[model samples]
Target chain A: AQTVTQSQPEMSVQEAETVTLSCTYDTSESNYYLFWYKQPPSRQMILVIRQEAYKQQNATENRFSVNFQKAAKSFSLKISDSQLGDTAMYFCAFMTHVGGSARQLTFGSGTQLTVLP
Target chain B: GAGVSQSPSNKVTEKGKDVELRCDPISGHTALYWYRQRLGQGLEFLIYFQGNSAPDKSGLPSDRFSAERTGESVSTLTIQRTQQEDSAVYLCASSLNRGSLNTGELFFGEGSRLTVL
Candidate 1:
């Protein structure tokens, strides 16, 4: 069983600043996928960024990026030029590679991020 | 038609009552997922359905929680004899297909908030 851990329970960043949310996972499988999801107060879960374990290059999406260290089992999300709208509950998730009955995701406890203006 | 849609945006029921939450996945999406998010908690995997195949219900908390998907379209999660612990936001997500080592992005619904009184 794979478990994702988000050590930071809450994080705050001033507008236009940068913040990183920590995440780590326990998985024996070398092939997997990691994702960061944001859930706003409206309760809509939105994808922030994703990284494939096979790819050593980190993934970037606009202001969101992930530092994926497969060896360390750490995948942290960095948000640059943070805006107030970025305030939400961020979650780290892990899933096995494509074709399998175990395509379900394992999520971390989550980190509440507040971008203060 | 545009994205995943969940019904009963808010549900309030008494303990021991049965409640059903509905999810309409995105058109043409072959994979659907159900998750539970308790207040101040991360998303917890409940089940996953791929097309018409038997769903992976390993994440279901207990036999009391059951889900059904018809024609790989809409899915219904039923909680029999609900308990206070069942109160949470039930989220539904859909992806293009079963995620292998390489998975596609997951589009999520706004979620159905259930409150057991």
Candidate 2:
């Protein structure tokens, strides 16, 4: 079974600063995908970033990026230039293909991020 | 709809009452997912549907929880004799298809908050 872990329960950052949310996973599958999702006060689960295990290159989307260390089973999300809008609950999830079909996302507990002005 | 839509955004019912939550996936999406998120927690995958066929229902907590989807459109999750532990935000997400290993990203709805007293 795959499991995701987010050690930080809460995080805070000042506007224009950077914040990094840590995530780790336990999976035996060599081919898999990792993701970070942000849920705002509106309760909409928005995809923040994604990383494919086969690729060594870290995925970056604008100010959001991920450091995926396959050997360590660590996939951490870095949010640079944090804005007030970044205040939300962030979750780290893992996905893998099983018998040519991808399985459902396994998520970590989550990290509550608050951006202070 | 422009995005995944979930009905009864907020539901409050007494324990032992049955509740039905609805989710309308984005048109053309062949894969739909249901997740449960307790307050301040991460997403718990409940079920996954690929074109009306559920290949993964392993995340469902108990027998009281069941879900069904019609053709590639709306999906309904029925909770029989709801318990207080079922009080959480039920989130619905959809993707083009789970078979697309490289480019599929789950688009989520606002979620339906269920509270059982």
Candidate 3:
């Protein structure tokens, strides 16, 4: 069994500023994956970034990056140069790599992020 | 569509009524997933289908919730005698056959929002 937790319920960042959303997960499996997804008001879930347990290097995509601490079971998402479009509900998810493929994702409670001008 | 598709973007039904939500996964995708998100909450995984394997229903909250996928394409999640607690967004996602190969990218649909009054 796996569980993800996001302590912050809401966060705000000024346009062109930076913000970091925190996440923590509990898992017994040694091999797994982590992901961050953004859901805007449009109701679409978009992939933000991903991290692999086997890789020590955090994953980054464009202005979105992650700080993955495997020992602490923490994975946080950092948004640099935030824009209005960055406002959304951010979700942290975990997936165990069982027998080579992906399994169901365990998601956190979510953090609502608002980017203001 | 180039991405996953879900139908009945918004469904409002009275408590005790039955509701069905549909999902169309990306073509050629071998994996499909169903998840639930309550208001101000993160995703709650419901079920998963991979290739021709037996679907995993471990995450379903109760017997009132059931889902089916036909030949790795369309999936339908049905709630029998829904309760007020069933009000939430139902999300669907699909991933390439690479799921077993460790590529965990899940293309998601816009989701079907259900309101039980």
> Which residue segments of model 3 deviate by more than 4 Å?
B52-54, B99-101
Q: What ordering of candidates by DockQ runs from best to worst? A: 3, 2, 1
- Clashes per model (N, Cα, C within 3 A): 6, 0, 1
Q: Mark the regions of model 2 whose C-alpha exceeds 4 Å error after superposition.
A: B98-102
Give the lDDT of residue A67 in candidate 1: 92
Best by DockQ: 3
- Residues B21-76 of candidate 3 have per-residue lDDT tens digits of 99999898888899998987788889999964545789899999988888778888
Ten contiguous residues with the weakest lDDT in model 1 chain A: A96-105
Listed per candidate, the RMSD to the true structure in angstroms reads 1.8, 1.3, 1.5
Candidate 3: deviation at residue B116, Å?
A: 1.9
Q: How far off is residue B43 in model 2, in Å?
A: 0.8
**Per-residue CA lDDT of candidate 2, range A1-117, in tens?**
999999999999999999999999999998888899998999998999888789999999999998989999999999999999999999999998655566688999999999999
* TM-score on alpha carbons, each prediction: 0.95, 0.96, 0.95
lDDT of 3 by residue, A4-114 (tens): 999999999999999999999998999988999889998888988888899999898999999999999999999999999999999999988877778888888999999
Tens-place lDDT per residue, model 1, A47-88, is 889887889999999999989888899999999999999999
- Worst ten in a row by lDDT for model 3 chain B: B96-105
Q: List the residue pairs that clash in candidate 2.
A: none
